[model samples]
Target: MKKILHAGNNLKGKQANPTYISFLGPKLEAVGFTLYYTSQKQNKVLRLIDMLLSVYKYRAKVDLVLIDTYSTSNFYYAFLVAELCNLLKTPYITILHGGNLPKRLDKSTWKSKRLFKHSKLNIAPSKYIMHEFKKRAYSNIKFIPNALNIEKYEVTERGCERLKLLWVRSLTPIYNPDMALEVVRLLQNEGLDVSLTMVGPDPHNKFEELKETINNKKLRIEYKGKLKQEEWYKLSENHNIFINTSNFDNMPITLIEAMALGLPLVSTNVGGIPYLIEDGKEGLLCNKDDALTMVNCIKKIHKNPDLRQSLIVNARSKAESFSWQNVKALWISALA
Candidate 1:
């Protein structure tokens, strides 16, 4: 089997919720690749240290170093590791996962070029990132959709009565968790009986603030602090509509999972979301930061049976295309 070194924030025991590496590592292993990960450490400095040491240790043993490249400070982790891989004359590939990556490149062109220009290839999980890269004249790009085992997600008859809404994402400002509550508030103010459940980990202490906001408003919103994939899916049974209130985003796995489970999607048309979901087709897309519009879309889906059924059918079809069974060949070919 070919050995692959995956350098990312592999916070297995430490994280409140699992990262994408947790999902991808196993799939790669099942397809005949031995995977190694770095930085399960809680400290950022230690994580960087672990990543550098991992590359050095696996330099001769591994076929390629797979770096989980981000647009934030995590970009430096990729930069340092990629620089080391270049010095060792080892080929490495970057899996681009940042929604704000283009801005990172534009802000620091020199560093971005040094990293992208040196890597063997850059894997974009969405066409949005691919289009952004192409605009910057960055070649060596590969389009690979993020994969999930479809069997794990169960589809149910999803005609919602009380407007049971669900929002799942990290409790961060960028994701705009507050807007989810606002949407729920608007629905209730209009005398619609709606309930919301927010499921995610709190890395930036945003959950406590959100909890306070929920209490102050005295809304029927439940804050589920960080659930495992199975736990969230089970909770999703009570919900029919999935709300994504992100001010910015990429191809969110939560949205895809919601689509797979036959939940009608109401998301902001930002970043890679438009690429994943078509407005009024696969799912409903509202303008970013438009809570009133989001509320209207939910009402439209609730009252219109034909529109609701059409969205579910098309969304499931879209979700099926992203299953691991369909995507495994792409990874096998890329690794080969």
Candidate 2:
């Protein structure tokens, strides 16, 4: 069995959504790969130090290092870790996670090359990211969509008489949680009976802003801060529609989970989302921050039961392709 050191945010118990390492690490272990992980420290500087120390400590024992690469400040973590891996003559693979990474590649060309070019392989979770990298002449990359246990997400029967929207993402500016609020407000203004439930952590303290908007607009919105996967899966049963209002996104696992649970999707068509869901096929798509378009999309599903059922069926079918049973083999092969 190959020994792998997975490096990324492992803050499962820290009231944050489980990152890629939290999910993929266990899957790798179950398939006979021994796995070690890094820094659960919430502080940025401390987390970087802990990650570097883990790499140094496991340098001799592990056959490979798996770095969860992102586009923001965490990008520096991957760069420094990869640099250390290079110095130590250890092979490392970068698992790309940020939806805005294409912009990073353009903005930090030299750093991107230094970090990605030297890796054993770069794993892209979406074709959107893969295409971006290939366009920049980065050939040592592969596409592996994020995976989940499809069987765990039981499909729920839904009704359209009263629209219930479900939004799951961190309350961050980039995700544009405000757009979800605006979408709900617009639907209510149209004399439509709509209620929204948001589930996520407020690392940047954006929940207060969301609350103020909800109160001022007098909208029916429930803010369920940071729920466990199963907790929100149960809450999803009450919701008929899933709204993804992110300005930028990669292959979000929540969208797949919503699909598996039989919720019709209405998402902003940005980054890899269109690649994930075909417009008027598996789900409906609108431009970023355009709440009116999203409202119209929801209205279409409300008026047409056939369209809703079709989207639910098609989306669930697409989500099955992302199940761990199907995707584990790809990871096994790639690691080999």
Candidate 3:
């Protein structure tokens, strides 16, 4: 069997683990590619060193390498690893995951140049990043969305009366977990029968403060820390609406999974979210950190049965486009 060396920060402890390497690596292995991983270390500098060593160690063992390139500080990891891969003469491909990566081009032009130029190809899971790279004359890029096994999701009918809101992502400041709490508080103040369930690991230890705010405000919220893929989908059956309050986002698999399970989304129009969700179409979009607008959106969806069902139908249709059955061929062609 051929081999693949995947280099990325595998969010090992996070509950809503949407790491692309974890999702795609096994799929590649099932099709006869032996997958190897590096750098589950939380520290950034150590992770970069680990990734470099991984490339050197697997230099002759792997068929190709896959790097998860981000637009944030982690972008340096991709650059350093790509430089090592170039010296080793190993062909590598990068999967772009940063929503704010367009700025990376202007800020770190030289590094971005070296990273993409050395790679055999760059796979962008969202058109948001793909368009930005293309405009900058980066031609070694391919648009392939983050995908999931559709068979795993179970769809259920949702009552538009009670707002059973669900938020799934790591409890990090960037994701703005606090924003979800504030939205729930605002809605409850208006006497809306709303409840929020947040499912994800708190890597930053922010749970105590978050819990205090919830208790202080007396909000109807439940924190289910870190659920398995199957467990979350099963939990979705008891919920209706899915909320994504990320300050920055890429093609989030949880958002796609929610749509597949027929959950209408009310998310901030930041990063790649707009690219994935069309306002008043597949899902509702609001401004970042605007609790009032989110409250209004939830009220709109709750009152209008027609609008709610329309979003469900359209979102599910759009989600079907990202199923593994549809994306498997793209991976096969890329690897071949």
Q: Give the TM-score of candidate 3.
A: 0.95
Expressed as tens digits, the lDDT of each residue in 4-74 for candidate 1 is: 99999888652355768989999998877899888798889999999999899989999999999988899
Better of 1 and 3 by TM-score: 1
Can you list the residue pairs that collide in candidate 3?
15-226
| Residue pairs clashing, model 1 | none
What TM-score quantifies how close candidate 1 is to the native fold?
A: 0.97
Model 3 over residues 215-250: C-alpha lDDT tens digits? 999999999888988898889988888998999887
Tens-digit lDDT track of model 2 for 1-336: 899999998875636768878889988899899999997888889999999999999999999899999989999999999999999999999999999999999999999999999999999999999999999999999999999999898888977899999999998888999899899889888899999999998887798877888899899999889998899999999989999999999889889899999999999999999999999999999999999999999999999999999999999999999999999889998999
> Which candidate has the highest lDDT of all?
2
Which runs in model 2 stand beyond 4 Å of their true positions? Answer: none
Best by TM-score: 2
Evaluated against the true structure, the overall lDDT of model 2 is 0.93
Candidate order by decreasing TM-score:
2, 1, 3
Ranked by lDDT, top first = 2, 1, 3
